[model samples]
Target: MSLLVLLFAVIPITEMLAVRLFSGIITDGPGQFAANPLRVVWQIVVFFLALAVTRSAHHLIKIVRVRVFRSGFQAAGSGVPPNKESWQWAVAFEMSNVSSAVVQIAMFAALFFAFDPITGIVGAVVAAASLAAISWLYQRQLRLQRDYLETRWTPEAVAIPDRVGTRIKHSEIGAFVGTAGLLVTLIVVFARVLGGQIVTSDAIVLFLGLRLMFGQFGTLSSGAMRFARAAVHL
Candidate 1:
């Protein structure tokens, strides 16, 4: 929910981990010692720059979502009741934009600046493909929303009572977090044994966890919003 946390805490921590991870696997001879100070400084600068870019994008997406949702409402006619579910979907769709863009930027930045790849071509291809995927999803969602608006679809009436699903167990949250921890452990272990990088690989794995958790957060919050909306009928 707070973009600032991602910008300040998650972004920097992940990037620093990237820097450390790459510095190990992709060595540039003994001169690395002399250049480490500069490298560290440059990474700090890049982190701040990335943070700025991500923060701006995050805020911009929110504004766009708000305007687009309001426009859809107006297009549907002011007399119609709010379709809160549709607006909620719009928010999730737009947040995916931020999430995907951040991943692309962060990954490519890591490839180019932090870790030297096995081959230049490999790095280039991966970065391009990853970013393309992100862009494609971002555009696809926009088009979907546009199509939805152009056709002004109405929400079907429901007779179900407005109540939260009693089936959702409280342990689901613990299960989710526990799964995230397992993933981090697996990633770190593989990076160490296969890649032979300790500190850096661990950092990379942690960053992976952060991104995954952010995504899970979005999904969980969206479900919670649906429950709240259903409760409104009460």
Candidate 2:
């Protein structure tokens, strides 16, 4: 609840005030504020509303993650039928992922026809890229969860780690790739922004989304090794 308040209320109000102050410092502050106070008020309200919706989306994602992990931890492979919790968790994860993708498409299509078509088109790509990153994270979680279940139920499932790859940790590989990707993304974004090709907040957000998408690609390394493939059901 406190986090919700911080995201929806405190942050929005503070941001609006800061923007207003900066706007005032450069030009007419009282004149604009006096002319249409409602416009300023509406902007703040919209900012807060957007943040609140994002927070809710993230909360739902967390619920799905927890359920998947919990069920995976309790799963046993004794040649018996899977329990309801495990089955439900697997189905729910898949359905939620598909639903999220569908909703994103529907939203982008509706918004494109209704509002700014160009921005909406870019938004659709960004949305797809964002979902890809989320899927990447989910894959990592799924691998860990699968291993947790197998290590307990089927000792044979746990394969020996390759000594060759053991020299450098997975975290090192991820960090190397993610850092390089972040640098490349920042350079590209800054170059475009400096060249005046990208304007508007939406464009900025889209570029950053691409950054995250590239960063998440680093996780593919975890699924590359033979031992990793055998253990994680990848």
Candidate 3:
């Protein structure tokens, strides 16, 4: 879990640094890089180093997840019944979905703090409200999923009804739209309120950071929906 958290945190920071480097080159011109060649090289090296760490962490986490799953399945013995599909979904929900949602939530919080306290507070409220709405919808969808699974247990059939699937799609779409809209509003607010006080690089970082933060939100939302489906089986 620590490795997972570190992996998530490093990803956004590495992305932000890459964006910052590119933006700096564009804003300051190629002459700056030419003047400080060593600095540019150092930044590039750091980026690659971080990339290596991220890959290593991801690989290690995958190994750990597999081992844990194997151990749990072995412990369950006859009770588990050796359903490949069931076991796969259980492992996904237990390891990937839950950990990703948690790490994403923490990343969003950290991104909120990147701006200001007021924005952080506002983000917290928005996050809570959005999650509550999604949770309520998911509860309804879960009921539908349970009903569908109870009656439709074919090997090749669709897992959910059209209505439920449509709702799930809309929920994901709504999350993206909400995230984009919120970030847009923040950009406008910062522009009007802060005026020339904010640098171009800062604006770029804000955009990228928000993108990463809410991209994770979209993932987290999708994971939650998957969990709803997986829950019926568990």
Candidate 4:
């Protein structure tokens, strides 16, 4: 378990380092490299080293996950038909997803905070707010749907609950609205860069960081939802 955690933590740090190196190369140009050839070579070597470590970590994580699943399967009586195979896989996947999301969020937040405290705080707040809203709504919907499923499976089936349908519609609307907000944020950031309110290189790095951070947020959200569902099944 400690090894697994270390692997998960290492991935995000290496990924962040790789991104910073690549971004520096793009922003600083060849002139800087020409001035310090050794420094440029060192950066290039470090970038590839980070990439290699990231890849190796990913491969090892998969192996660890498989071993974990197999161990659990054997302990649960492997010859008993493995009826919940899909559920097992789903649970395992969500477990890894949650771990990866958590590590990525912490790494990204630290990176941002190291660069600019205000940006870090704002990013954290946005992530927390978005997560809280979506999680509450999703959990409520899951409960309603679970209840509806149980009812349907009974000897005397009833119609689906109106609350479940309403919640689903609301969730869909929220998703679209969230997407629109993301687009608007991107546009505003671009405008700020153009207006010289933000440095071009800073804007690029910020955008890249934000993109990665939000992606992990989405993964965390979905993983939590599915993990909850898997729990219900259990």
Candidate 5:
């Protein structure tokens, strides 16, 4: 899972860096005016970035499910083993994340094409809030189902370690906030160096996805460490 996260995060940063560098060469050349090919080139670039963003979002959902299952299993063995049920929940979450991303990108693209950066950012926040709210509701429904199952089975209950859940929670939040801040700073610096033309609201949406991906990667990687710690302490 750590390897997967590293791959997802590194690939995009590398791809974006490469694209930025190539764009620089194209724009700076003597015949820069002649380089105006179709906008397809930009479209292709954004498509790849969106793919990476989607993967990260999917991975985060996977981590969240894994954690929940572990918590549920510890709470009550029930019928399914925690790890097994966790994967099931992860698959369900991944599907929902994909649907959410499509809606997010569409909404962001529409608003970005319509408004200025400030308005676009406001729209992105609203869109993100809506996405998060929907996801939360889905998870809540799943929780109720899990509770019903646990009650039916009446498996032995055990306390989950704070380290198992709390650390991952903190790590996820920190990574998200840190990554978002970094992206914002980078965009500001890029705007200064390359000019304000690059400061579109679309970039903000992409950064939001990037931060979300890293946060999931961090949380998933932490879960394995928590399991190891539990074994060692026992």
Candidate 6:
């Protein structure tokens, strides 16, 4: 609940204020915001709405995850058949991931399309590249989850460290890339505003690098090798 408040209320409000003050940098000119205050407001509102929807979807996914585990436990008690929790988990995980991707697409479109047509074209490419990386990571994780669930190994026989990764460590890679991209983009944006400079190739490179890094990180896991092919994805 507190996290939701932080995400939907504090963060959006803070970011909106910052964007309003610095909209010139983000959108390419003072004229952009000057002519479109309502558009900026609507974009911020939509961003926060997307965040809320993402959080809600996460909660639904968690419920499905719990249900899968419960099914497994019930199967164990009944001795009627092998539990199908593994398959259920995989399905639910993938669905959750897809939901997240949808949110990102919506948010990205809102922000990217706000710019002029030329800048929007570049923004669209950069956003798509980032999303493609995330999709690749998710696909790998889905495969890993399938492997783990079908494996002959039992949870009791495996250590926690052995179960942590079946997919790539995309988040860490994304964090690194995202941080770098954010830094470069921030500099370019501010330089354009404060110094009257134009967009540069370096910004485009930074965006692409960030996308590639995120893709690599999202699919790579730490402990995939320890488990057999039948084990669950991390």
Model 3 alpha-carbon miss at residue 186, Å: 3.9
The candidate maximizing lDDT is 4
Error of 2 at 218 (Å): 6.7
State the weakest 10-residue window (summed lDDT) of model 2.
Answer: 4-13
lDDT of 1 at 153: 43
lDDT sort, best first = 4, 3, 2, 5, 1, 6
Candidate 3 clash total?
0
Tens digits of per-residue lDDT, candidate 1, 112-180, equal 333333322333343345434434433443443344444444563222231123113322442344345
Worst 10-residue lDDT window for candidate 4 reads: 173-182
Show where candidate 2 strays beyond 4 Å: 1-35, 65-168, 200-234
Per-residue lDDT over 147-197 for candidate 4, one digit per residue giving the tens place of the 0 to 100 score: 755777786554556643565464564454334434544665666677776
Could you give candidate 6's per-residue lDDT for residues 1-234 as a string of tens digits?
223223323322333333333433355444555888777666657656655664564465456555655666577673323475464444444443444334343443344334323333444455556555555554565565565566638753434455464232444544444344344444544454456443443234334333433232232222122222223432
- Candidate 3 RMSD computed on C-alpha atoms after optimal superposition onto the true structure: 4.2
Error of 3 at 38 (Å): 1.5
**Whole-model lDDT for model 1 versus the true structure?**
0.43
TM-score of each: 0.42, 0.41, 0.74, 0.75, 0.29, 0.42
Instruction: Output the better candidate (4/5) by lDDT.
Output: 4
1-234 per-residue lDDT for model 5 (tens digits): 343344334433433444443444444433543566445456446656656665675566556655654566567755755556655455434533343333333443343434246434643554454335434433443453344435544654323453235435543543454345445534543554356554433354434433443334333333333333332222
The residue ranges of model 5 lying beyond 4 angstroms of the native Cα positions read 30-127, 140-234
Give me the displacement of residue 137 in model 4, in angstroms: 3.2
**Highest TM-score against the true fold, candidate:** 4
- What candidate 3 gets wrong by more than 4 Å, as runs, is 29-31, 55-63, 75-78, 84-88, 115-121, 151-164, 177-185, 188-194
Give all candidate RMSDs, comma-separated.
10.6, 9.7, 4.2, 4.4, 13.5, 9.8
